[model samples]
Target: MAEVVTSGAVARTVEDLSGPRGLPVVGNLPALVRGGRPHRTLEEWCDRFGPTFRMSMGRTPAVVTADPAVIARIHRQRPDDFQRSAHVSGVIDELGGHGVFTAEGDEWRRLRKMATQALNMAYLRQYFSTITLVTDRLKRRWDAAAESGRAVDVLDDLMRYTLDVTSGLAMGHDLNSLEQTGDGLHRRLPLLFPEIGRRINAPVPYRRRVRLPRDRRLDATVREIDALVRDRFAEAARRMEGGGEPANFLEALVAPLEGESPITHDEVFGNVLTMLLAGEDTTSSTAAWAVHYLAGHPEAQRRVRAEADEVLGEHAFPPDPAAVGRMKYAEAVVTEAQRLRPVAPYIATQPLHDVTFETEQGPLLVEKGTPIFSLHAYGARRDTVRFPDPEAFRPERWLEGALPPESLPFAPFGGGPRFCPGRNLAVVEATIVVATACRGFDLEPDHSAGPVGERASFTAFPVNLRVRLSARR
Candidate 1:
C-alpha cells in the first residue's frame, strides 16, 4: 500500500522520479488537453507512478501527488512554500477576478479575512432568509414542472436558483436569474470554469494568439458582468450614505465609499465578480449532484426527506439559519456528493523553492517553480482503505463518529489558510437546496435523456443529469 508523503528525508530530484512518456516538446500537455477527464487522468497517473511523481506541460516541469497527506502539507504551506499555480492566477486575472482567490502574499492577507468574514456562518445567518426565499422560488418552478410531467433540467435550474440567492443576498441586486427571460448571466456563468481549465492547460494559449468567436463572446460577457458589478457597488455606496444599515454583502463590504476606505474599488469589485461566478456554479452543481445520487438511491432519498421534514416541519425551505444547520443528514448528503463527485475534483499548487517530500514510498526532492497538481478526489473516491466501498454514495460515512480520528482526506473546499472563503455559504446554501428538493419532490433518473457522467470544466458537474420531479405520495 502507498503511504502519504511527508517532509525531511533523503532527496531525489524530480528528474529521478517516474511518469508517463511524453512527446519531445509537448510532453504531457497533449494528454491534459485532449484526454478524457483530465482529473481522472492525473489520478490514474498517481496510481501508476506512486505519490509525488513528475510530469511536464510543454517542457515545463509539473508534479502530481495523489496522497492526501502531501496535499494537506501543500495546503498548510500556503502562499509561502506554495501558492495557486500561476496559470490559474493568470486566467482569473484575465477574467477581472483578482480577489482572494487570485491574490497572493500581502494582497492575499489583506483580502482573505474580509472575504472569509463576508461568507462566514454569521453572514449566512444574516442572509438565510434570502436563501429561503430563493429556495421557495425554485420549489415553485419545480412544482410547475412536476405538474406538467416534465423532466427538470436539473443543473440549469439549480444554477439559476443559486444565482438568484447570491444576487439577492450578496449585492441586494435582484438578478432573479431564475425568473429572468434574458438569461444573459446564466449563459455566461457556465462558460467560465471550462475556459479557465482550457486556458490553464493549453500549451500555447491559442485563443489569445487568434481569438475565436467563442472567445470574443466570452470577453463580451465578462465585460458585461464587470460593468453590472460596478453599478451595484455604486448603488450600495449610495444606500450606505443614506444611513441605510448595510443591507446586503456589498453594503456591508464597503465602508463609507466616499473617503479613505481601506479596500480599493478594484478589490471589492473583483471579489464581487468572484462571488457571483463562484457562488452560483459550485453550490448549484453540488446540490444537483446530491439530487443525482438521491435519484439513484431511493432509500437515501427517503432518509434525507424524512430529516428535512423533521427539521423544516411544513416549511418548503429551511425556516431559519438554525434550521439549516440542523439538517445534518442533508449536509452529509452534500458532503458525500463532494466526496464522490467533487465540484473541484483537483487543485493546482506549486513549490516556491526546492523542496523535499518524504513519502512512505520514499523521499523525492522537487525543484522551485514546479507546478504541483493534486487530484484531491483521488483519496475520497479511490482510498478504499479510508472509505470502505469507496465508489458508493454513503452519506452516513460523513455523520458524527462515522470515521476514525485521523486527518480527513476530503479536500472539496481545499484546506488551510487559503481554503475556500465561501465554503460555509456554499455548504449551507447547497444543504438548503438539497433538503428542499428531497422534502418537496421525488426524483427519479430521467433515463430518456441519456446517461449521466462526470464532465469537468474546472468544477466537475454531472452531464445530462436531468431528473423527473414528481410530487410525493
Candidate 2:
C-alpha cells in the first residue's frame, strides 16, 4: 500500500513531502521563531501534515516526524546510519569538545563505555551519600526561605541543588552554590548551556562567522570552567596515584589509566564537561517541573509524601539507595513528570546513508545528510492517542498494572544505542529530590505571580517558577 519514489542520486522529491513553504532561502525560520519554540511549532505542523513531513531551516532540509513507530525504527535499526546533526554536534563540540554527548561512531562507543562504567549503578550507590549531603544543604536553605514566608524561585534552587550534587559527585568538590552568595564558577557554568542552545537554534551562524560579545564571554567562562575541572581532575589523578580509592567520576576515570584502551586526559576533561552540562540541567529541570505539577495537584503530592514516609521511615535524611528504590509511588511521580515535561524536547539526527522510513501514509525515501528531528517530547510523550488524558498530571499511570508495553511513544530519555547513559542517575536523583522535598515541606505555587511557563534551553524547563514552601505538619 506504500509507494516508493526514487530520483537520481536523491530519495524523495520535494513535492512528495507535506509542510509549510516559507520565504526564499530562510524556509520555516519565520514560523519557528514566530511560534517561539520550534518543538511546539513542529507539533502544530504535525497536526496539519500528518505524522511525517519535510521542512527546511534556512537552506538545510529536515524531516520531522511524530510517529512513534517511525521514530522507534530510526532509533533502533539505523543508529549507525544516523547521528547528531551537524549544527547540534558543532555547537556542543565547540563548547564541550568531543565528549560522549557529541562524539559519533567509534569515539562515541569508547567514551560511552567509560562514562557508563564511571556512573554505573554501583558508582551511583556509592555517590548517594554525596547527593544526600548536597540535598540536606538544599533543605536547610529551603528551611530558611520558608521562614521568610516568601515565594522562592524553584528552578534556581533546584539548579543550585543539582550543581552541588553533580560537582561533588563528579569532581569530588562541594560548590555549595545553594548557600554561597558570590558569583563563582558554579554560577557561571549554567550560563554556557543556554548560550549553547541559542547558538544551535540561531538562524544565522553568528558564532561561526564572527566573534560576538556573547561568544567572547562564553570563551572566558569556558576557560574558567576548564581551569576548575582540570585542576580537579589533576588532584583526583594525584590521589589515585597515591593508593587512594577512587571516590568520584574523575578518580574513576583516572583509575583506568593503566587499563587497556584507557581514556586520555583530554577525554577525561571533555567527559567531565559532558557530565556537568548533561547532569545539572536535565535533573534540575525535571525536579522543578515535578514540584510544579505536584504543587497544583495536592492529592498527588499527599500520596507521594505518604509513600516517601512509608519507604524512608527513620533514615529519611540520607536515604539509602535500596530504600529509595522501594519508593514506587515516588518513582512513578518522577516518571509521570518526565512524561509530561521532557527536558530534551527534540532529538536531532542526520542520516549517513540513504534510508526509507515506513510511514502510515507511505514509504518515504530519505536521502543522506537530511536532518531528522524526532519531536519526541511533543510528538510521542504527549500524543493523546498514545496516552489517554495526556495533559493531566497522573502519576498512577506509571504505577504497576498501568501500561504494560513501555516501548514506543514513551522514550523520555530518547531510545536505542544513544539512549541517555545517565538515565538511572537522573531518575534516582530526581526521585530522591522529589521524595525528600515532599516529605519535608508542602510546596504551593506563588499565585501572586503569574503561572510558570515553559522555556526551551538545552533542556525544556518551567520558566519563572516561584513556590511558597511550608514545613509539613
Candidate 3:
C-alpha cells in the first residue's frame, strides 16, 4: 500500500519521473514540441512513471505532479513553499508586473484586493447584460454566416465577443470590435498575444535566435495597444484632476491604496493587457466547448434551452441578472466543458521556502527553489478520487454536489488563497454565453473539421472547432 506521507515524514523517493534526455542549454525544446497533445502525453508518462516526476525544458529542471494530496499540500497546507514560478513571473513582469496575476507577498495581496473589489459579484452582475449583448451579437453574426452557407471559424468570433466585453466593462473603453468591421486594435489583440506567447514559451536563445517578419508586425500591433491604453489612463487621470469621482476598473485602480503600493501606471497598463489576454479566450473557448457539447447532446441542449426559457423568456438579450442566475444546466455545461477542455490547463508555482508535503503514494521533498507544476486539467478530469468515470462530459456530476472541496479532483479555478479571483466572473460569463447561444440556435458537430486539438501557449484554445450552428425553431 502507498504510504500517506506528510511534511514531517522522511523524504521518500519520487515515483513518477519519465522524461527525455537533453543537452544543457536546449534541454527539452525538441521533445516538448514533438510530443503533441503535450498535456495528455505528460499525463500518460506520469501514470506509467507514479507521483512526482522530473523533466527538463532547455536546462530548466521542472517538477510536475498529478497527485491530489501533493497538490493540496503545495496549494493549501504549505502554500508558502509554492510561489509563482520564476519563468512564469518573468513573462508576467514583461507583460504586466506586480498585478494580481504576477505580484507576490504584500504586493500580490494589494493587487488581489483591488481586483477583488473591482471584480466583485455586484460588478459582475452589472456586467451580465453586457456579456449577453456580446453573445447575441456573436450569434447573429454566426447565423448570418451559416445562412450564407459559409464556413465560420467559431474560434475567431468567440475571441471578438469576449475581447469586446472585457475591454468595455473592465477597461472602460468601448472598442466595439464585436460589431465593427476592419482589422483595428481589436483584431490585433488575439494575434498580439499568441506571437508574444510563442516568444515567452521558447528558450531564451531560441526565442532570440529567430526573428521572423511577423515579429515586427506583432510589435507594431502591441505598440498600438499600448498607445490606446496610455491614452485611456491619461484621460482617466485628467478626469480625476477635474474633481469628479472616476468610474470603471481603469479609474478605480489609479486611486490610492490604504498603506500599500498603489497599482503603478506601468502596472496598470500591463494588467489591462493581462486582463484582455488572460480573461478573454479562456472564457470564450470554454463557452464554445459547452455550446458544442450541448448541441451534440440534444438532451443537454434541451436542458439548457429550458433553463434559458425560464430565465430569459423569448428575448434575444438577457435583460437582467435574475435571468442569468436561473441557468442551472447552463452552469453545469460550463463546469463539464471546463473539466473536458480547461483553458488554463497547468498552473506552475515555485516554492519561496523549503517545505515538505504529503501524497497518496508517499512523502516527497520540495526543495526551497524547486519548480512545482499543479496540472489542473490532469487533476480535475483524471483523478478518479474526485469524480466517478472521469472522462464522461456529464453536467449531472455538478448537479447533486458530486464534487468534494479542495483536492486534485476539484481544482478547476484552483484552491487556497491564490485561487483565481475571476472564477465567479468566468462562470457567469460562461453561463450567459452558453444559455443565450442555445436559445438563439442549435449547434451541430461538424466532423469534417476533425477533432479539437489543444493549442498550448500561455493559455490553451480549442483548435479546429468547426461546428455548424442552425436556427432553432
Candidate 4:
C-alpha cells in the first residue's frame, strides 16, 4: 500500500515502463481483441506486469493500472491532473450522449450540480413506489414465465425493468418494457453500450467510412431516443406552464435555477439520456450477475430469501427505504455481486498534466495527454491480501464486514468527485429486484441453456445466462 508521491521526483517515463512487446504497427490490439473481455485481459496484464505499465491498442499508447492508490488519485484529480478520455467523450458526444458524464471543465460542474439534485435521496424517496411498481411488474412478468415453463432471459428482462424504473423517476412517465416487447428503447439501449466500446477500441473509425448494419441500427436508435427525450421535455414544459412544481428529473432540468439562464433543450436531452444510460445497463447487469451467483450458491440464495421474507412480511415488495434497509443479507448479496462482477470494470481516463503516480511497485512518470485505464475492478477483487478468495462469490463475506477501511478502491459506483449520481437509484432497484425474485420464486439454472458467457462493452452483462424461474413450492 504505497501513497501518491507528488513532492519528491522519483522518475520513470512512459518510455521506460515495461509491458508486453507488440508486433509491427498493430501492437497489442489483437491480443486485447482475441482476449475476449478487455477487462479480464487488462487484469491478466496487471498480474504479469506489476501494477502500472504501458499497453498500446494499435498506434495508441496507453497506461494501465490496477493499484487502488493510483486509481483513486486519478479519479480525484479530474479535469485538472486527469479527465475523461477525449476519444471516449468524442464517441459519446457523437452518439448524442454529451451530458454530465462526458462534459468537461465548467460544463461538467454545471451539469453535475443539476444531475446531483435530480438524483438526491429526497427524490428517490418520493419515487419509492416507482421502484416497487417496476419490481412488481417484473415479478408478474417472471410469474408468467415460471407458470408456462418459459425460460427467463434475466439480463434482457432486467434491462426492461430498470428502464421502466428510470423512465418513471427521471422522465415522469411509465415507459413499460416489461409487458411490451420487440424493438423498443430497452432493446435499443443494450446495443448502444457495446457499440460505444467497439468504437473506442477500434484502431480506425472504419464504421464511419463503411457503415455496418449495426452502425445504421445504432443511428436509428439514437434518433428515436432523441425524439423520445424531446417528447418528455415538451410534457415537462407544459406542466411548468400550468404552474405545477418540478415533479420529476426532466422538470428539474427544464425549470430555471436561480442566477442561471435556462439550459438549452439539447443540454436537457443530453442529461436525460445520461440518466437513462447510467441507470439501465449498470443496474440490470449487476442484478443479473447476482442472480447467476445465487443460482449456483443455493445457501446464499436461501439466506437472501429468508431475509427478504422477514423484511417484506406480507407485502410483495419492501414497503419503504427503512424496510429495504432492514434486509441486510439481501443487500449484502447485491453488494457482493457488485464487487465480484462490476459492470464498468475499468475507467477510461487521460492525464491533463505530467505527474508521478506512485504504485506499490514504484513511482512512475505519466506524461500529459496519455490515455489511462484505472482497473478498479481488478484492484478490489484481485488484491488477495484484502479479499482472500477473490474469485469466489461469497456474499456472507460482505455480511461479516470482510472489507477493510476505505472500500472505494473496489466500490462499484467508484470514488472521488465523479462518483456515480444514479448509485442510490441503481442499488435500490437491484436490491428490490433481487429481493422480489428470491422471495417468491426459485432461480433454477438451466443445464441446456447454452454456454454462459460474458461480454464487456461499456458495462459487462451476462451472455446467454438463461435461468428458469420456478414457483417456490
TM-score of each model, paired residue for residue = 0.93, 0.94, 0.90, 0.95
Pitting candidate 2 against candidate 4, the one with the higher TM-score is 4
lDDT string, candidate 1, 1-473, tens digits: 12324454446677777898888999987886564478777777888888667888888878788776778888888898898888888888887888888888877876776777678777777777787777778888999999999999889899888888877766877767776666577667667777777777667878767989988988988888777778888998898888855767788777833333467777777887778777877888999999999999899889989998888786667767788889888888998888888788778878888777765557766778888887766777777877889889988987856564224466787778887778778888888878878888898999777898777666677778899999987
Query: Which scores greater on TM-score, model 1 or model 4?
Result: 4
Inter-residue clash pairs, candidate 4: none
lDDT per model vs. reference: 0.79, 0.80, 0.71, 0.82
In model 3, how many backbone clashes occur? 4
Off by over 4 Å in 4: 1-10, 402-408
Pick by lDDT: 1 or 4, better one: 4
**Whose TM-score is greatest here?**
4
lDDT of 4 by residue, 372-418 (tens): 88888776676787777888887777767656533556767777889
Error of 2 at 237 (Å): 1.3
Order candidates by lDDT, high to low: 4, 2, 1, 3
Ranking by TM-score: 4, 2, 1, 3
In candidate 2 the C-alpha lDDT for residue 257 amounts to 41
Give the winner by TM-score: 1 or 2: 2
